[model samples]
Target: MKRILLVVLLGLISHFNFAQNPTGDWYGNLEVQPGVILPLVFHISEAEGIYSGTLDSPDQKAFDIPITNVTYTDTNLSIAITDMRLTYEGVVRSNALIEGTFKQSGLTIPLQLTREAVAIEAPNRPQEPQAPFPYTVQEITFDNKEANATFSGTITLPKVVFKGKKKLPAVILISGSGPQDRNEELLGHKPFLVIADYLTRNGIAVLRYDDRGTAASTGEFTGATSADFATDAQAAFDFLKTHPDIDASKIGFAGHSEGGLIAPMVAATNKEVAFIALLAGVGQPGDELLMDQGYLIGKAQGFDDEMLRKNRIAQEMMFTTVKEHYGDTEKIKEKLTIYLENALEQNPEMIPEGSSKEAMIKREINTLTSDWFQYLIITDPRPTLEKVTCPVLAINGSLDLQVPSQKNLTNIEESVKKGGNTDVTTVEFPNLNHLFQTTTTGSPSEYAILEETFSPDALKVLSEWIIEKTK
Candidate 1:
């Protein structure tokens, strides 16, 4: 939900001759918070100081990044990289320990650095056999002039057989809200991969890829909006339509979460799209969804009914005011700050009894409070949906908190009907979370611990709907 840069400061002083090379491998650990430590590795040389590094995150693929601006004096050294907006300020102790704080994105997080005395090996995890689907995965890049960016991603295809006797039906997998990889599924479970395998085995081909700025893709992921992401999906659709093995007439799209919003947009312009699947997509404006999300999260965290009501009222008011003054950054910030201050004073116990007003202000301001959230609050998905003429299948999880099932499903159905399309089908899965995993108590915290893949029932519903419609 928030974008943060990781910075590590290594203070190492070298008294060696200038002619001596300053190239070697360095190791360090970054402390984003009291208990959150991220391990990192960087290599420095005299010509470029620190130029390349990798971040150690179990959930993220290892990335290659550049470091710049290295300075050393006596036992103190300072290094900074403007490109990453991070700086490492530290001292080299007599014991050869490099310690400092990594500063970036208007906050200074702590970090410690050390020389790698021996080679450090990456952890070994059991690798599953190649996906059962007869598909080939390859990286591809495309340009998006609307967003002023170029992005890269992987395309998974069913291996050609029988000398391409017939073009295969294809679908593009769109991810939900987050920095998702090409698979769009993780944590020991791959929903897209499962769908791809099932569809491929059934004689349908699939294409899945990383979002514009995630994983191997190139571009800034943080500054993007749902509309921007839609362009990325459109690019992928264009790629598939041109593939030699793909049936241009049978191309379609399937989206999850925010991806659902993108499906209609892509289908609207390309009449050739055979169909669309909206899995837990949003029907109302983003602002309404945010307030609902906040209320749900607050309630699940044990906030009383009165407290929830007050919080929702304040959030709605703030969002409404923001919508009224979209492009005026100064007025928006001033009004938001005043409203947040008043809201805190009204219910001092709303957030913790002893929390300071200043602390609360800082926390609220740090969130998505600017034009992005304002624009999102007023933008509705119905306009795009009405333009879509293809057969539509919209699904929701009854236990979803982010986008309440009843409200979202109602919106989709109403929009489709208004568009003169009576063939829309809606499904609400009981006890299922946003990710379509069946769970009694659904919460974001539960996501990191749950290992179940996308529900088989949900997949069956989708596959059946697509096959039936296309037939």
Candidate 2:
């Protein structure tokens, strides 16, 4: 009887080990909000007891997100990738149920997974039309030792009718803040496509691609800084000059938002660039801009001057603290933990009640703060503008709240003048928001609802300017 019992126990233990491996397909549903079900499918595997898989989000139309370093011990499972890390501490009962919480982006959200007998299929959607550029889109790849990765992008050009035809002028489109697709436009806007179409139609080639680590490109986007992005832009410019259809002498850059900053960096380095266009680019450093943004957001939400002042102080303190201890992460974290507690006790109203300090700190750190903010606060775009020997067109919308046009464009104009670049032109479109949408009131909320395509006026102005410059 004792021998039989031991055999049964060993069999049970082996079964449990096999069940917990988390290999094969696992289907789950995410509750983003009440009544909102986001279907998720994960293909999990184990390599030396580490969990690895790809996640597919049906609701987001996102698929094949590579997940690595996944591990499960008893009821607890955790996964970590380069930028995203998630831990699931829950039970797997009867070899089917996986109920737990998934921690990501500093917030812990509930997640449930179950082994499905049938395979889950994501909803099918029609593909977007290929770019209408006359020239074939070519893939360009380059290595950046600073970012420690190889970055790649697509270069679209005008079709060459014959050889020795004057080399076509080109522009490199830089994306804004966020994980932008190669086009740099989402939500049906397809701004890159629209811009590429227009520019290529006007005999100008354009290069636009997924910001490093997005789509087919390599590298970690979340961990990168503006200077890192500038390196990628430089690589793109270098690639363009080598193309047979491109005119090495007339190349320029047109960047939007953060991309705008990158444009100047490339132009500053490459004197061969003929011109540059700052399309709603930031003129000030990131930390200052963030403070301004917070204040504006507070004001828009009807916060009084005193409240705004207090919040600004808190933000500034946070920036200084983070910068001071950037390299010493352990000390920075310890100080931040203490500082956050004190901050909450002193100014409970600054952050929402019941919000986790850990979550806030996580959100505040990473590339956005550590790298981008640090670079922005220190490096003045004006130096790049001054270094630029090419003509420049800086456009901003009067209603843009993200990078307030009044201050940014004014700074640009002043900087260009100081740099002695007389060819610089600045334009502000009234009632247009950061995305260049003309609206009754320029607000971010309006962007989701309005889809008029790239502002025709803006496109016309851009095309005309390019034509005149290339001519």
Candidate 3:
């Protein structure tokens, strides 16, 4: 449950009379959240008086994103990536400086562009394996007939194949949330790639794929719920069962974040699933998990008690309304609208500085009633875990704010045990954030800055556990 940031854009200086050559590279830092900063670079070029450019978010490992529109007149400059619904409007303050506002979704943040490049050192991910490796890697695709979706992925087979012994045990790596590629790449780190490499090197086969409607996979991701993603994971499991190199009896799921939720859902009814390793998986109801997520992250980020209280009130009301009127879009919207109207009446500060109260209410209602939001807010994972009889390993970072360790881990073990399944193991790694990276405050703002991709101790724990289970 990622926290949403909404704030009004501040005023910018007036346009100057002199025109600055907006060519070459322009750099800036985007204050995406309160404490998170994403460094952006715009590579602009002029062709016969027509300007075109590309944007790069280096921290996110994104590069060469097309800038569909660019207009430079006098001292005013504007650029838009229509596909991303991202726009930047600025006034050239000098030959080397431009003050602007970066707007995406419904939130606006101030951004300043400058000619001097910001020094962003590449993150050091020692765990990420290089090519020409010891394992056999293959690019592949599997189809989900139910979803009518084709998933593109990489399958790594250990070099040490069993001649007369048992077949290779395999696990499908599932990503958390968002439009993730096969690597589960984020913040310049490829956790899946590293995991696949380590496990394959340790003689366990690994299959990691892009989510449906993400990257090379074919399907619509938007409006799809966790249930839909479970079908996709099931499709992956089915594919591995028929593969020549994989042992059908030893196949399992290793999911991170939301993927953790999907793993239990798949294993609940599918007795064939060998085991499941949940990484920062949620054990509580979706609504409760989200409320805790908001509160924990807010507190970690130093949000005032009053602000946190209001946010909790807003989230609680919205989630409760959605759950009560589950599927009744009109009723949910009406209830949320009224609730927000009352909230804003009591706390005028809830309204964004430059936004109208009605507009804010409408936006909040629309988000809370959205298809994915509704599904996430209403789903509970404990019941699914209770039905799962397979071996379960639920692990989390003690400092993780996204899915706090103690609450979720306890629920996971108890739920599985309550169903008469005793093959459950849970561990809480201290000082680690959501991604398993050792951190100070465990704030997401620290994710990109810190270089250690996936913690080596975590990798060792995961690989050793899988080996023991498979053996």
Candidate 4:
């Protein structure tokens, strides 16, 4: 399981006065956890009077995020990011160094920045939509009474001239885990945005939204689990069902990763969900998925078998601890801590720097006890897939390491077909990563550097399958 790390605004020094104009790529590393270094890049540029720049976390695959309010007076430098409620303050040590602290979500970490390069080239995403899009785009809002929250999203309809008010088939796009914007923006690539554009251009109506408590949506993001997010998707379905231009019988759901799991959860319970398209969705229980993820990713990263075995054992024990302490949140944390500490004592190298066994155990405890992880560990999509009688399409990238393509696709298809759902289709595209982007190595780190967002072939398959089902 990955430790939860917050992304803070990367700062750059622009010489407005005595300070040497450090207008270039400044690089730093944050110890997100023991031995794990997250690379952060800040590109500073000076035009006239405006200090405009962008931030990129190469490790996270997030790039060109706008950093605002850049003001630096000599050694005293302060950068503020209003969107994330974060600020970075530090001192410029010389012509080449800046030492500072990154503050976000009430957590602070020391960061030392050095001039990495003169300039860094941004990733090329030519698939991103330009002006004069061929789809009719409209911003819309819908309310989910169960969570007492309102969601904001965009609906894209094919631009073809219809004979009167045609009832077009529609699909609601659900993003993977984490708080995502309407486009499911990640690493410099907006996969959902590309997919929505592709589907809408192909004459399929599409709805994609910001997660509750993310972007323009309201409610708490930290405490809500995947099931809670499913309700929001259901609400989107309800809204689409009543749209004046949408066909009630052709409305469907297209979910990615965790969103794929949620698609079945909603589809199984709500008969109105006509179909579902799962993209890199998991078919096993949440806890098992985590353990598998750790093993595979560790293997790819060149971790020894012994190290991976220890990881798996710790994961299994953690799951057991949580299961045993189910509803007792406080006690669960305590039990999980003891469990992990014991595991770490047995394996010393597993402990990260700047973090003792106790600290590592505490971090794991916090994550395992959260509403999301707690719910995720126990939630199984197999039963829900079995109950989903609607036409289903499950696709995974051959290079997808997070959700192994062969295992998950086979299991998901089997589960659906076992339920007597004969219309299920599963496909795995070669050389594509979790985001369906063509890559050399399907590593998560490769996600941002790759210029291609969503694979054209994947988009074609998804849009065609969705269109065929809606028909």
Among these predicted structures, which one has the highest lDDT? 3
Worst 10 residues of 4 by lDDT: 1-10
TM-score of 3: 0.83
- Model 1: residue 60 alpha-carbon error in angstroms: 7.1
After TM-score superposition, the amount by which residue 378's alpha carbon in candidate 1 deviates from its true location, in angstroms, is: 1.0
> Model 2: number of clashes?
3
Candidate 3 residue lDDT tens string, 1-471: 122222221112222344457788899988776545679999999999999999998666578998878999887899987556578999877878889998875569999999987664555777778889998998999999888899999999998965565689999998998778999999778989999999999989999999988889999888888899999999999999998989999999999999999999999989999999999998999899988999999897777899999898888878888999999999988887777888889898766544557767766776777788899999989888999999999999989999989999999999999999999999999899999999988998788767788888888889989988887
lDDT of each: 0.71, 0.72, 0.87, 0.83
- Mind giving the per-residue lDDT tens digits that candidate 1 earns over 1-471? 122222211112233322233235556755444433346665555544433333333433445555545666555556665544567777655443566877764467766666763333322212222644356766677666666666666556667533434776778889887778877755445667666766665556778887777776777777677777888888777777788877788788999988898888888887878999999888988888898998897788677899889988988887787788876767777888898888878777754422356656755654545444555777888888888889999998898998899999999989988988888999999989988887877775455345555777898898888767765
- Quote the RMSD, in angstroms, for model 3: 9.1
Ten-residue stretch with the least lDDT total in model 1: 3-12
Judged by TM-score relative to the true structure, which candidate is superior, 1 or 4? 4
Q: What tens digits encode model 2's per-residue C-alpha lDDT throughout 267-307?
A: 77778888889889878866788888788766765679998
Q: Which ten residues in a row have the lowest lDDT in candidate 2?
A: 120-129
